[model samples]
Target: MKIIAISNQKGGVAKTTTCLNLAAYISKKKKVLLIDCDKQANLTKNLGMEGAKTSINDLFLKRKFDVVNVRKNLDLIPSSVDFVGIDLLIQGELARESILKKALDRLESNYDFVFIDCPPDMNLVTVNALTASNYVIIPVQATQFSMDGVNIMIDFIGGIRESINPKLNLLGILVTHFDKRLKISKSIEQDFKDNNWEMALFKTRIRRNTAIENSQHKDYRMTIFEYDNQSKGALDYSNLAKEILKLIKNLN
Candidate 1:
C-alpha cells in the first residue's frame, strides 16, 4: 500500500477538502483509508463521524481503535479534539517520531492507498505523518502567503527526509481554490512558472466552487462526486485521482 500525507503548515488551503474528495474519487475502484490527524477534526466532522467511539487518538494512545467503513471501499480513522494535546503526551516516549509509523505498519497493508489529513502546523503529529508516509502532497492557494507556506513545508520535508524517512518523496504541489477569472490567480500561476516549478506542479487545479463547499455542509456532508458529479469540483478531483494513480504507477 502507498501512504500519502496531504499536508501544508498553512491553514485554509483546502487540505481536508482535497483529502476527503480525492479519497472519495479513488475509492471508486481502489481500497482507500483516511487518517484524520488534525485536531480540528474537520475531516472527521465532514464525514459525519464526529461521535465515533474510537479515533486516531486511540491509535496514538495505544488504545483500541476502530477502522470505520464510511463508504464502499473507503474507511477512516477519525480524529479527536483530544488530539490537540497528543504531542505533549507522546513527547516523553521513546522513538516518538516513529510512533505513527509503527501504528500504520499494522493498518496499511490492507488498503491500496492511505491518505492522511494533517493539521495546519509543523509539529510532532505532522512529523509523524511525514515519517510514516511514502509520499507527500502539498496543497496551497494561489496567494503569496500560501506560497510562503509551501516553501516552509518544502524545507520541513527536507529535514524529515534527511533524518527520518529516507524513502519519503514529494508527490507534487497542488493548486487549490484556483479561479482563472481572478488576476491574482493568473499572477500566481505566472509566479509558479517563473520559479520553474512546472515539474513539481500538478496540472489539475481545483477551482473555487460553491458545490465543493456545500457538499461539506452539516446538512449534506456528502462527497463532491456524490453531491454533484457534474460540478467542476468533482471533475478536478477525479482528474487528480487519475493523475495520482498514474504518477504512483510510474514511481513504483
Candidate 2:
C-alpha cells in the first residue's frame, strides 16, 4: 500500500480538496482509506461523518478500540477539533512520535492507498504525517505567497528524509486557486519553474473555479468528473490522478 500526505504549510491552498477528491476517485476503482490527520475534520465531513473526539487521536495513540472497516472501499478515520490535543500529545510522548506509522502498519494490507490530510503547519503532527508518508503532495495556492512559506517545508522534508523516512519523496506540487488572468499568479508560476520544481507541476492546473469553492462551502468534494464534471477542475484532477497512478503503479 502507498501512503501519501496531502500537505503544505499554506492554508486555503485546496489541500483538503486534493485529498478528498483524490481519495474519492481512487476509491471508485480500489480499496482506499482517507485519514483525516488534520483537526478540521473537512475530510471526515466529505465522507458524511462527523468528528469523533476519540477517532484519529485514538488511532494515533494506539488505543485498543481503534479499528478500520470499509463500506464500498472508502474507509476514513474521523477527526474533530479535539485533535488539536494530539499535537501536544505527540510532542510530550516521544514514544508516540511514530504512532501514526504504527497505526498505518495494522491497516496496510487491506488498503491500496492510504491518504492523509495534514494540517497546514510544521509541527509534531506534521512530523508524524511526514514520517509515515511514502509520498507528499504539496498544494500551493497560485496567489502571492504561493512560494512564500515553502522554505520551511522543504527544510522539514529534508530533515525527515535524513532522520525518519528516507524513502519519502514528493509526489507533486499542484497549483491551486489559480487565475490565469492575474499577473501575480503568472509571475509565481514562473518563479516556481525558475526554481526547477516543475517536475511535479501538473499540466492541468486547477483554476479558480466558483464550482470548486462552492463544493467546499456545501461541504462536498466532487470528483473531477463530479465537480463541474466537464469543467477544467474535473478534467485537471482526472489528469492529475492519471499521472499519480502511473507513479503509484511503478511502486508495486
- Among the numbered candidates, top TM-score falls to 1
Write candidate 1's Cα lDDT for 58-87 as tens digits.
Answer: 888884678999999999999988888898
In lDDT terms, how accurate is model 2?
0.76
Task: Give per-model TM-scores.
Answer: 0.97, 0.90
The TM-score between candidate 1 and the true structure equals 0.97
Q: Please list the residue runs of candidate 2 whose C-alpha ends up more than 4 Å from where it truly belongs after superposition.
A: 52-54, 65-71, 219-227, 250-252
Query: 80, model 2: CA deviation in Å?
Result: 1.0
| Residue pairs in clash, model 2 | 224-234
Q: Residue 78 in candidate 2 has what lDDT?
A: 82
Weakest 10 consecutive residues of candidate 2 by summed lDDT: 62-71
